[model samples]
Target: MKTVGLALAVTLLATVHVVAGDTRFERSLRNLDPSARLEQICDYTAMLRIRASTPFRPDRAVGSASSPAKAASNMLVANGAAFRSRKKWYRLSYTCKTTPDRMKVLAFDYKTGPEIPEEKWNTYGLWR
Candidate 1:
């Protein structure tokens, strides 16, 4: 019975992995020119927020984003799922730049909502 249970668990895990294939957002992030480096910068929760949100096209961004000079060159953008926590709607924006060396995060901006305003994110953005 123990062996059977273990096998079933493994099979379920594998099935989950296969079912959750790379999403478009996942693919874009993975295929970054210089490859993004996010481990040291972001914690598990932050990463989770970004991963939970995907296919961050401009239209779905909810707010306007203006790239800052500080955001390295060749920037790529993606947004995470929008969620409501404690009566507040929140969203995550992952912006990174691919330099000749490696992709580095320019900003991970968390925008607050009820009514998200359209503004230059790099200039007036909040970071987590």
Candidate 2:
């Protein structure tokens, strides 16, 4: 009976931790900058990790059809999802970039396969 009680307590603790983490993620999304510029948007550098849910595909057609700059601009306007590591929970940041030519939004994963070195992510729009 004692062992069972102990196990139950551990399970409850784990569940609480998971719920708290999720809450933090939601809060982060709410805190994202709604008016950040494309250049200043992806300028995040830290031991942080981000998780994006939306599909991310390079706008090759746009790049070929227009100029490289224009294609990059279109990519940033697409909608997507993103997750970042924070003190207590992962912060979620969503981006939606709209310009006269195009609009896009997306979620991004900063802590993907390999650690992306701290560098300037110069582009013309927002990323999730």
Candidate 3:
């Protein structure tokens, strides 16, 4: 239920840091492999993009909540993903597509479900 952003970012930042641009983020992506890179960008996208208005700011995103994310070519789909806003964890699912180089996000879609039960948190490897 947290992030490093790309997987690189998701893997990079254990928690999100407010930034003005992608300069530092871009540099960070260079450190991750392709699969991780895909996760990172998409995870970052989840926190940054959304049409449905929510109250709190999501500070973190996890590519895998109850299961590992699936990747194929330049696309990554994570059905068991989750994100943390303030102190609550919400169910999440996301689909991420990247450019040929797998460095830029070409398209992304995600939906956040209900708040996860605290009792199920440990089972899902979620933390406080």
Clashes per candidate, residues 3 or more apart or on different chains: 2, 18, 15
In candidate 1, list every pair of residues with a backbone clash: 53-80, 53-81
Q: Which candidate leads the pack in TM-score?
A: 3
Query: Which lDDT tens digits does candidate 3 get at residues 1-128?
Result: 24544567654454445342576888888899887888888888888874236665888888898889999999999999988888888889999999967788888888889999989989888888
Task: Estimate, for each residue in 24-114, the C-alpha lDDT of model 1 and write its tens digit.
Answer: 3445455643323332222222444444674322222322223222223444343433332333334545444433343333445543233
Cα deviation of 80, candidate 2, in Å: 16
> Candidate 3 regions off by >4 Å?
1-21, 51-53
Candidate 1: minimum summed lDDT over ten consecutive residues — where? Answer: 56-65
For each candidate, the alpha-carbon lDDT, in order, equals 0.39, 0.32, 0.83
| Candidate 2 C-alpha RMSD relative to the actual structure | 12.0
TM-score, candidate number 1: 0.27
Per-residue lDDT for 73-125 in model 2, tens only? 42342122222232122212223244423212344323222211223111312
How many times do residue backbones clash in model 3?
Answer: 15
Please give the ranking of all candidate structures by lDDT, highest first, separated by commas.
Answer: 3, 1, 2
